[model samples]
Target: MKYFTVALLAARGAASPPPPLPAAVALNSRKCRRSWWCRRRALGGAAGGGRMALLYRATRLKDRADTHVFTFVVTRSATREPDRDVTSKDFCCSHQRWAVAFSRTDASLGVYLVWRGACEGMRVYVDFTFTLLSRDHFTANEGFSGKQVRFSAGCAAQGRGRCITLAELTAKFADARGEFQLELTMSKVRTLYSCELRAPRLDTPPIAFAGFDWSVSASGGNKEPLTLRLVRLSGEGQRCRVRYALALGEGERRLHSGPLECVCDPEGRTPPWNPRPPSRILHKGVRLTVELVWARALAELAVSAAGRAATCYDRDKQAWALRCDTHSETVRLHMLYRDVHNVPRNHLRYVSWSAWLVRASPAPGEADADELPGAPFEHYYAQESADEGLMMETALRVEDISRAGCAFLHAGGELRVRLEWGDTYLLFQATYHVYDDLCRLHAHQMRREITALQAENYSLERQLFSYQKSLAYAQAQAGEPVGAEGTGRRSPAERSLSTDTEYA
Candidate 1:
């Protein structure tokens, strides 16, 4: 009978009891008749600015012998103000500022947790929400969701962590407001573990391109649509929050949306918005451009992921390259002429560029447009792959007009000028030869005019001399006219004859 009693006590101790309720939760249950409403109030929303009353929580597990104590920490913070300024402190953006970290001694087992918060690099106006994780992996919204908070302690090598949707978690436990309360129950068997709260580093942030606009019309400077996207590039496990503003001359105009949260995956993107761009966006005087900003914590992660030798931009004999490690390969886009303007230069009117990906670099002087990759429009890419992968060549042409003269870089290293003229499409390849021919023709025409002018001058000189001699002879004849026998005066002739007879 005594042995039986000992076995009964051992069995009672072995059977795990339900974990006790947290202290604040216990007080709330007693103070408020409507526990659900009280819990909802604690978890604030956009109407309340999604302010978090607590930042961390801890609870003992029922299976105490098998699992360690679980600790939750707030690594980042954010709040949503909806129509007000994000900086108003009333709401710091739940997406940018709110991130919860769940840590335990043995994370390999079940009990996957999913927590969501504001993400950087996205606008605040867009709709975004996150949820927590649960043990069930097969059910929808039960396992891991892609939304991850940075600066958490876990086995990051597992790559994507498990998560659950907000709808699945009880309202008492899930909240967007950055608030927390952990209840501690004294236990001799369980060891006390402290949770660390880390403030994200803000000094050096990830570098994002000054935002690029798609389909900027060349004619009226109009933009077609606004699609914002970014890649993690070199930052693995980096946390980034991106925001943009339009630069109006006097002051900046900001459009706030849900911040984009980055997880070093290549697929981070901002919500798409196609609203007619602000009238002032294209105004010549506004100088409006989209500006991108991020947090320093993200920058540090990207640097660590890229290693010491990696560079964002590099150049070599084959091509000038822009590197974003998120891409899969390296490519070469060879310019044709040495004198052609560098990238970012204004392309000439009506100039068209056709690009191709070739397995092998074309031989010197072997480039031809007809053999280029089909559907050149599809080849326009923002980023290239990350291998010694492909050589991209651009076939440049100018059309929509009768004639054109332009210069572009070629695969070979030389300055080239192409001239297309006349209805028949005569092409002149070399500028020097064309200019030389023009000079020769001009010289020939000048020589012919010189010869003709010299001959006319000689004829005029001969005619002037003859006219002068005739005048002199006529004057001499007039001087000798008084003694002439053929004179009109017959008496003079008779007088001359009498004079002659007297003289004889």
Candidate 2:
């Protein structure tokens, strides 16, 4: 009975429909509507709207978490089929906020640019998307380091899905004069996106000295009868290179010793200072050491273990350096050994800088020889005591202690001798603190070697893939009926490798 009455009432309701709603009321209820007032406002009050009629509508997708993604649809009033004007769209986001916003427009078609956030504050990762409404080519120009960079329709261009580093983007517009312009050119028309640049300054100061020092140190605390002086090779106030001369003995017997030259630039990419060992000059049985300590520069270098040897080895120059990196600066420690034949020239051998010197036994009559001393780690002091029991001493300097626990100097040990008629003795000790950081330097070198080897290994693996593929192709051509199942014959090269992996 209840079902029959319900059906009878539903039929009566369907027979008599409700009255139609008013035009204004119906338009107001829908999500979007065309308004003459809005069109007039878009025309800028009698200035006359351009040929392009604009309309814009926004739809908001809401989630349970209360977050929203607003998608905007724009169209032309005259045609409802499809709008082919927009080629691509990209947006940035940061700090839990969308970097772009849009407002509705009443004209049949509209184009707007919404931007926020400075280029300097841009994070390392940026998100962007491109929408291709047509097949026209687009291009943009950015100024960088006094050159113009053209970003076109191909790779690195704005696309459907893309991300870029802020540093890279900032570098592109680094030299822009307060503003950046993006140009989109088509067969029939051209559109543009221009915005003021808010990137950080990218000026690097001209090289200038922050500090410098040059001094001498002596062993045995004796006042030697020698003089050392430095002459500026460059002009006054110039700090690139320097020349020095040494003199020994006094009065008319004074001997003019080595006049050596060294280059020190505290303002260069790598400051020539303490890390760079002193120059060693062996002349007339006397050794002269000259070094610059604590120099400051405008730039720094990449740090390396084996000092710089692990990463950089120049066979022609025959020099080694160490580098350190900081947020704002990179520091380099450089050392140059003029005639070191044993130091490896190939970077691979120096990866760990594991090899060190061994103390060799002193040759007979070495104290009487006129030759300068050998490497510092080698303890080779000779003695010949006289009746009066006179004694002599030799102090050494080394980069690291040898296997026998002996120390060396910058590259070689220093030598000082006091001679008397008849017999005399020679003694030497290593300069321990001169290269106290040798162990640390070696450790860094090991790390660099490991990283480089890993990269090389990966590259070899990739190459092996190609080789295996070629081998598989040859085996298939041989008509051996190679099957995907087991029990297939293997090549000797493939069999040698223990891993039973196969490439098909």
Candidate 3:
């Protein structure tokens, strides 16, 4: 009976001419035969037409649901305890299990949506809204909302801190029984997929992440073990920790999987993969899949110190030198052979390094004193050779202290020197403190000079008075009449007074 039915179906299929297949379907006929959906379509097409089968497949691919909502309940006591965390049971959505956690710290409540699934090369971009429902489940209190929150292997949870205060949660969210429902509505959800591949030389293009272009490169071919590096093509300085899974080939043949930390600046790259055993060779076309599971930017190292200011006459240089012992913590840059190749050999390292003498806080309506151009001191860049030492020191100087240094001594303010070393920056500050002993010595010297000048002025006045009196007496002794001998001539006192007035 089965053979007879099959023969009848074959006769019917031959009786009617099959509709024409699309170019895509015709070219992939072998693939269609292997696919279950295509097999169903082929059976349906025997009755209907090939065009309907293709349309049906296309429609099914585009009709996937992209939105999901998960609801859970929590107790009011969870929001009262400090540093307490309450989590919901796992709920499945979009083939992934998700859970909502409420964390309480002091009086603030934080809401986080966590993904409980594998993060290997999977990134989910979602716009989510959190709502707190009352016991009646009728009135909804919106807790918080976030847009473009990405959940990936590196970052498994995304949420807002201080979404609601403990007082607000107690007053509005809980019911008479102290239980409340929390709803997480995830919308506009998008998924990005990444696949990792390892070859002797990288053949993949750069991928965009965190506003930078990142690509992989491999070095040490032939007999040497291969080293893979993550290179940043463009962007400012950034330090990120990358989690990746290393596999043997395109198949699920796993080899090793771990996290690699890297620091990359603009036009800089990082050497994170250094395979051991120097004899391990990577063939030209042999490929291994790597997954960029997680990535996070690391904060830079910042060190601040208070400086002591001093002024001394330099006998060797024969000049007055203003010295500031900033007591700064030394920051050393260790250069390895691998890292040296990534940085430029002859390039200026500092972006802006200058000394600024400004008040701690500017008065209102005054132009920001900090923004004013500072006294640019002399600086030079040092080049490193292959034979040079691995450690480098960063010591900047404020040379040629002239009138600016003297003014700074009198007018106390903050002297800030901002030194930029590649992507890292160091801010050295020195608050001016009047050297009490030096000021006293300077004041004593000025007082002695003033006393000598006052004494000389008194003696000169006395001598002038005596000379005028003697001249008057001699003129009177030899006079026919006081003004008869020379009518236009003036007295000695008058002449001296006129000269003094003209000089003044």
TM-score versus the correct structure, for each prediction: 0.19, 0.14, 0.28
Off by over 4 Å in 2: 1-70, 75-96, 99-114, 119-125, 132-480, 485-504
Show model 3 residue runs off by greater than 4 Å: 1-65, 134-140, 200-504
Ranking of all candidate structures by their TM-score, best first:
3, 1, 2
Let me know the TM-score candidate 1 reaches against the reference structure: 0.19
| lDDT at position 451, candidate 1 | 77
What RMSD does model 2 have? 31.0
Pairs of residues clashing in candidate 3: 154-294, 196-290
Question: Candidate 3: deviation at residue 332, Å?
Answer: 79
Lowest summed lDDT window (length 10), candidate 3: 51-60
Tens-digit per-residue lDDT, 218-298, candidate 3: 666576676666776655554444444444344544344355554454456665566443324444454544545434443
Q: Pick by lDDT: which candidate is best?
A: 3
Per residue, candidate 1 scores C-alpha lDDT tens digits across 1-504 of 232343345434332322211223211132321232233224422123211122222222335332112222221121111121010111112112222222111111111111122122222211122222212221222222222222121211111222222233323332343221221121222111111111221112233231211111111223433332333344333333344332222334533333333322333433343333433234333322233432222221011112122122111112222211212232123222221223222111111223322212344786522323432211111122322322333343222111232222233322121111101101111123222333355456667777777677556655765665566578777884433346555542234335343320
lDDT of 2 by residue, 421-484 (tens): 1111111112232122333444566677778877776567667766876867888899665443
Q: Which stretches of candidate 1 lie above 4 Å from their native place?
A: 1-139, 143-387, 397-406, 410-504
Give candidate 2's whole-model lDDT.
0.26
Report the C-alpha displacement of residue 105, candidate 3, in angstroms. 1.7
